[model samples]
Target: MEILSKNLQLLHFLDKEDMAGFWKLKMMILKITSHSWRNWISI
Candidate 1:
């Protein structure tokens, strides 16, 4: 039971870390997409 609880805690921590990384990646993609669109329109 103790081992299981520890594993759950680790999983939760990893989930939060992944969520943060996912958000950062999403923002980067959005920024790149918007920049490309602006360039396309300017051209």
Candidate 2:
């Protein structure tokens, strides 16, 4: 039971980190797309 609880805690922590990474990736993509849009507008 103790081992199972520890495993659950670790999985929860990893899930949080994965969500953070996912958001970061999304922000990066947004930034890139917006930057390209600005360049296209300038052209």
TM-scores of all models?
0.66, 0.67
In the order shown, what is each candidate's alpha-carbon RMSD? Answer: 8.3, 8.8
What tens-digit string does per-residue lDDT give for candidate 1 at 1-43?
Answer: 9999998887677877798897999999999999999999999
Report the C-alpha displacement of residue 11, candidate 1, in angstroms. Answer: 12
In candidate 2, which residue ranges exceed 4 Å CA deviation?
Answer: 1-14
Model 1 CA deviation exceeding 4 Å by range: 1-14
Q: After aligning candidate 1 to the native by TM-score, how far in Å is the CA of 28 from where it should be?
A: 0.2
Name the weakest run of 10 consecutive residues (lDDT summed) in model 1. Answer: 8-17
How does model 2 fare in lDDT? 0.91
